[model samples]
Target: MSFTEPMGRQRADDYRSAMVSSDPLMDVAAGLDAEVAQYFLVSARCGCFMQAARSLNVRPTQLRKHLALLEEQLQRTLFRFQGSALTLSRDGQLFHAQLIAMAHERKLPVIEQPLIRLAVAQSILHDILGRDLVALLRRNASVRLEIISLDSDLSLQAVSADVVVWLASTESPLPGPSFAVSEPERLAPLEYLPHIAKRYSRVTARPVSLDDLADFLLVQWQHERPVESFRPWHDIVDQRLAGVVQLHSYELMLEMIRCSACIGLLPGYMGRFDRGLIALPGLFDQSMQRQVWMAVKRESAGCEQTRMIVDLIRNTFHERREWFDT
Candidate 1:
């Protein structure tokens, strides 16, 4: 359960010898056990036994024992521990690479598709990435995607998601050293414009001032309101709006606005999809803008599947630059 000392020169020699044994029978017969290989791979990716245990749904002591047994069988120290922190040794990295290759080779000939986990805000998923993801799946039947709608308090590290797309303001802080994160790719800020269904616009007189919003029902997206930065408008209209209906899903909010006599704020890009919606004039304030960003886990950054998803996301924002513009 304890690994206080670092791998020394003698241990390094033993690792190299085990990796390239002179006996061909020893090499072939002593290939890594499947279950133990899984333990080491997960531990290396997680950077610590505790986290690896949590990920594998096993006790830390059990995981440590399995790793220790694997090291004994190979005559190599695969991991080093300083205090409570665990890291893979250089030999471990080489072995890990070999294991990954073996895994990929085993999945050949249409057995299992590559799975990429994407964690994103509900609004973004509903309004933007949903359609794009559908298109991606249709084009590439070999790719499988697991889309997780980010909760207010969800941690990307906890979910083991490969990529994350979220509003910058609501992003979770970077995880600890045990988890590796790639540099974030910042996207253009999205502009939210007030939109009313044509049916609602027909019955109400459209005024040219901010005060006009006070007369209509304000349908607010749960995450975007109360537009606190735009105090002039927030104070005069949003806070004093006669009726407010808060919704969690953008799709539902759009339907509610389209069918009822209410005003809703939606991303400008959405206007292209719903022709029945009309933008309310004189309410496009700068405070309605929100920045968005995407990040990938370092472990998954080099994966081709992950790269494809990242490219798709970046392209989605790029193609809609005009919709996000202020």
Candidate 2:
């Protein structure tokens, strides 16, 4: 259409006619929406109507309208609500994952600056002070931090992590080449609690000490250590208890603790860097401290920004060490 042309009724009618029946635009739009709703639902982690709505970043009212329209088109309820809780019907789950897989390559977040690949032990991923360092570097747009967690320093699998955070002994005969970043604290044992599922509430807890714990359970990240000699917390086996109950994930260990199923070691103070988990009087001694390292690959040897972040970790922990917590 020419700019000189008036958008009169006749022109509007012509455009509408062109855009419909004989035109393919509506079909294209409809197709695009099919992909959009699914992507929004997956990224949002919303299984039902509300979940899809929340993930789409649209208001519930607007999402409801879209969902109603979608359900009307499909002629089925995607979810069933019972007692204020929303549950996905079969179709909702099928469509949910599809959205995520479709959007994976199309929408990975990107930043323009050179990124600092930071490999950290998953356990210390509690409240990283990295964002401050990241923002500081962003001034010159120098470095963006890529955070990955590995259980062991041996598996520095991150092809890109110029720097890493590791927990080690002040006494280990390990390489002193890596610089220290944060001081470590002794990991003390928490009482084992029951961790049965709600339906299966019949569970029990047994007390075991460092000597009698050889038969107890220990949580270790298999990716970082093998089953027999797993070292989730600085080779807890070296201290050698009687028997250990083994677990793999830190998150899982937390879940186990929540369920009151197993006893595990927890960091005493200034952990979580936010709330801080504190040890009780006889539970674990807080006077003891451990050393954390911010080691760099020989390749990034002289990078000032890398050194700066290590300093940030050290200073953050040192300055806030008083958070002696619960």
Candidate 3:
């Protein structure tokens, strides 16, 4: 079969019966299908059916079949044939320009290098930063990311990681050249508290009174840094609240809050995003704002891959600061 052939009346009739029963022009007018357009673009680039087919790793006849489908959809001739040479029609030239413009509209991938090992606090991993982190990691096709979730103390010990994100009190900072961003450590009540006060409820919304905390169970994770260093927690410790309980894992602490087991202490980032958790703004103390730091080992600090990952974490948080508000 020749590469360019007239559409037989019988084939056109069959196509009409099988697919385009009514308003074929409407379907064609919507847009040229991507697969059909891609084939046409390849044909335009190669300037011949056989060469385009070879470049696309398809048979010459198969390429012609695709081009035929495109022509049928457009109801216009895209190519003109003279002996063995091929030339683009006016419609084809316009389409080729459109496809090139569409290609330019796409965003180029950002980071392109090797594997990056990143360790972050487990709570941070599952909370606000999780979705954005995953999306950023995927933008770079060549990156192979190994993400480890740990406590800040353990994360610091994970020297094997290329970069580490940890939450620390201003009193006890992470060791290294650190990009420290302060976010308040917030407390959550077992029930929802609106930001505005109502006469029916004693709980004041935005600046919740510290006295209201006495009514809820106080939950804490054993050996968590912010709790030990923050002064309000020390006050809570002094009182030895009647309902205080300690859990080993942050996940368990969150589940306890969901079940009304206790009022969970949450970092500002997680508290803002969790619909299930209500912020007890009364419990937020300015002196207790914890610093979230992204750090690397002194030796790896200058490595290009490590710097790229660290910069991404810092810049993304700076741009979306509202998500981490107390």
Give the C-alpha lDDT of model 1.
0.68
Give the top-scoring candidate (lDDT).
1
lDDT of each: 0.68, 0.47, 0.59
lDDT of 1 by residue, 13-87 (tens): 765565566543235224767777778877887787766776565677998898887777767777887677776
**Model 2, 1-326: lDDT tens per residue?**
12223557765565455444523333333354854465335423443454454434345577667666655665655556666666544444333333334457468453354456677656665534555555444443225567777565455442346676655544442332344433333322112111222321222423223333344454433443432212324355456554444566777765554454344555444223323122222322222333455666666656766776666666766665554333
Write candidate 3's Cα lDDT for 1-326 as tens digits: 23234547774454344333444433453366666666787788767777676555566788899889878777878798767778777556544545554556654234345677787767667774588777664443335678888765754564467676666655445452243333322221111122211222344432356676666567776646344445566466448648777888877777777665366566645445665555555454444555565656556667777777777777667666776544
Candidate 2 — what's its lDDT?
0.47
TM-score of each: 0.57, 0.40, 0.50
Higher-scoring candidate on TM-score, 2 or 3: 3
Indicate the worst ten consecutive residues by lDDT in candidate 2.
Answer: 187-196
Position 272, candidate 3: lDDT? 57
Candidate structures ordered by TM-score, highest first: 1, 3, 2
User: Which has the greatest TM-score?
Assistant: 1
Against the true structure, candidate 3 has what lDDT?
Answer: 0.59
